[model samples]
Target: MGTLTTTGRARSVGALFAGVALLNTATVGLSTAATLIVAAGSGPGWSGLPSVANVLGTAAGALGAGLLLPVHGRRRVLSAGYAVAAAGALVAFAGALTTSLVPLLLGILLVGLGNGGAQLSRYLAADLYPEERRGRALSNVVWAGTVGALAGPALMAPAADVATGFGWPALSGPVAVAVLATAGAALAAAFLPRHVPVRQEVPVRAPARATGVARPLVAMVAAQLTMVAVMTMTPVQLENHGHGLDVVGWVLSAHLFGMFALAPLSGRIADRWGPRVTVNAGLGVLALSTATALAAPTAHTSGLPVALFLLGYGWNLVFVGGSAQLSRDLAPETRSRVQGTVDAVVWSASALAGLGSGQLFAGGGYALVAVVGGVLALLPLALLASRNGR
Candidate 1:
């Protein structure tokens, strides 16, 4: 594999970062708003439905992208996804206006679908660079989400104010923001360069068996499962403990910050130490974070925020590392299908976690959820250990 020219690389990376940032910003904002809406309209126990729908949408989008990218190419597929996301934003906003749970859920599901496609940016970036630099490329695109994640919730105040002035529901503001952001991302994607780097050329070597993808895929699934299981309920927990929406926003922002802010550093770590090591390290961090949250006496305590932040950070590390390892191990000719399948499975597991997280929290409490998550976090470690021993 050859290096991409500096200018070419920069242009491609910048475009990807911009598109990813916009979509992520919308997704995060929608996530917060959707949960609140569903909780108020339905019950706290059902809050996770929107997120579950979102992840399901993402899963569908990932699979669809896999099928489309090889035929229609990245730009067309990405732009279409954004367009669909924008439409979903409108649907969600309408749900807020009508105070109907159905529309809100439907809207979120569509947004999730769009987000699923946007998630492919990392894969695209990975393909654009040489193997040695693939981690950095992927992480850089992921890091772009830091901007969106932090700014997304901050926009809520103004959006709500505007919605109030317009006689619309408060939640409508954030969905509106999502619409504009996703539309902008769609426009940005439309201009992306179609020519991927020469490094993406499939090698002539005989491909390894598909079973080689299972290890990293499992790691990816475990990481996402634990992360979603905990994250989807954090806001509900805080609100239940008397914290206002503002505090929830801030806490979630912190968590999102952790998810994206240090992506570059994580990528570097993966490159330096190997993805397996990074994945293992992530699992440890997740376990510690969950235990900390479990140990906290109250939801209002400082431990919750700290735990959420570390949880997000741990998830980021594992996701990036596992993604790198998976990408590196697969043959380019079969990469798209394999990546799509693995992501679908991982996201499907996350979807299940999102669906069950609220019920778990309602039935048992955060401690029960955290303990279960901690146990799941350890599975990848055990698998990794077994693989190493073999």
Candidate 2:
């Protein structure tokens, strides 16, 4: 409405976008450990702490995110979430060193809290831009995280080895990674500019109307949860097929590369196709990919790579699709609260998937895990699609 060209606004908004995405490095560090730790043979009982971490972090994050609406504001909470989660990472590393499962779990739960709060980072892009430009901003934030996620595992191996050389378990990897990611928070608080002012031009919509606006947002969030739930856990599942780390890593990198590489384009797809179309199409593709991953659990042939690679590719589409939609779904009056609620729930759902995946995989093989998991995951997407982009 003012003198700012849309391009100029996006340029300014991109800084905040980078901050939010950079903070996603925490997810890379934490989730890498979250999924891999379960495969570490850290006693069956202890193997699940990472899952518990996901759940607990997300639950608290859901609540704590509400706090950002009023007191600290998004910038403060985003910055603080990174720093605080860094502490949790330290605690987790300490726990990993001592092999103290309870404390390890607690520390990760705190990471979950940090993650919960950090979920708002993507929303920041939504806050800074207008509805028309929202998709690109959201995609930019995600693409930033994609780079960090790729690096996270590479960094984890060295940190883990260092921890082992010091007569400690390798869990210190995530802790070290957490610290690295926390620096982003410091940068955010220092360099990220505030662009959105505190006033609204119209009377606020009721929760009912806001919720109506958020329907696609919620659907997209669900799509995101399903995507992360499977893609994040794929390496562990592949490892079960007796695939070596080399094989798993190759496939995972391919998967991540597929997702990360396509993020910017995915946003363009959303921008052109309409958010609803993008979300639905992406989820549909994701549903097919998830089913393929479930059906073929290994890259024994290039087929496995092709299928799982497609899974990651499809996940990129849906996740970015959903994220872009959320960024544009609501008005400023409801921005903080609605965005917080959406992210908290999305992450909480992801946590549940990670936590439950372990039990599902342990009780059953990867095939059963795939079949059951695929069915469970399909429900949300099916419901979302049933509405046909409303």
Candidate 3:
């Protein structure tokens, strides 16, 4: 049979990849604002409000995982996620206006579902590409996501300014986010082929062996979990050092810069080195970042930011590795479902870390947080790095 190529397909898979950018913008941007506002407004600080965000985020993620199969197809699932996210944004915005925490939480929860599902954009890109180009193709799609991730938090300042000046609802940020998400989702729905998942939607044929695939999947999940855990705690760690909000914003941006700025190149690296080596290297960087955190002096305030940026580098590396590998392993028939399941596992673990981060910092202080995060970051890699064979 002839190889799969475009012509019958959409003009470019890249065009389809654009949907990921939109989803990332709404999900990441809204998340940034929601967490920040919650941090400021809630009584007990991260100890309380961020937990609400996590709870909502976790709930939404869980729901999305369950709904992925029954929702017609991947596009429909993604569209539904976007709509639910918009609803969440509206409710959250109204909550902020009315000073009702419940509504705000509900809004964030809706966005979280979209966030969870949208994350599978990488896998979608993988499905669109042939084996040879899959890694780079997945990277390009993830790179698109960075546009929104960077913009998301940056948008918050202007939005918060608007709320403060206009005497409108303090939740204007989500309102703006809702608009953007709605438009993007609609566009994605309209543009995406109604029938794209042709081979994908069918039932799967099992792979050669269970143990062979399980190790890599499990390793990738560990890498994902570690990346999220340390990454999540950075802001709180900085706050403990008396860093101001502006500093916090700058630090977060610096980390993103370290991460996505070189992501395209990281993808190239993974494609060349092969996924296993790339992922192992990623875990190494993460371990190094954690070690640095352990050594940072109590008098030094730079630990969190520096560590975050470096840890982000690890994430970039691992992201490229794992994404390509998952596509390689799974049956095309089961790709989206598998992607959803993998994300559910990764996000669910990270949610636990997110939920416990504040208490960890509070109880053990930044030092404990760093050490614990570091160990968790390194343990899985240590277990799997020997990785006898693919």
lDDT of 3: 0.62
lDDT of 2 by residue, 1-390 (tens): 123466755554565555545555565666556556556755332344476576668657756765454445555665666677667777776766665666667777776776665556556655556677667766766676566546665566677777678776665665666766666655655454443434433544543367444555556455555555565456676666676544654565556666666777878888888766666666566667667766666655665566555666666676666666656666556666665665666666666666666666567655655565456546666566667453
List the pairs of residues colliding in candidate 2: 57-112, 57-113
Overall local distance difference test of candidate 2: 0.61
What C-alpha lDDT values do all the predictions have? 0.81, 0.61, 0.62
Model 1, 104-171: lDDT tens digits are: 87888888778877787788889887888888889998899898878887887688789889999887
Return the number of clashes found in candidate 2.
2
Stretches > 4 Å off in candidate 1: 1-5, 195-211, 297-301
Best by lDDT: 1
Ten consecutive residues with minimal summed lDDT in candidate 2? 192-201
Best-first order by lDDT: 1, 3, 2
Superior candidate under lDDT, 1 versus 3: 1
Better of 1 and 3 by TM-score: 1
Clashes of each: 0, 2, 1
Task: List where candidate 2 sits over 4 angstroms from the true fold.
Answer: 1-18, 38-48, 66-71, 194-214, 241-247, 300-305, 385-390
Task: Tell me how far the alpha carbon of residue 196 in candidate 2 is from the true structure, in angstroms, after superposition.
Answer: 8.3
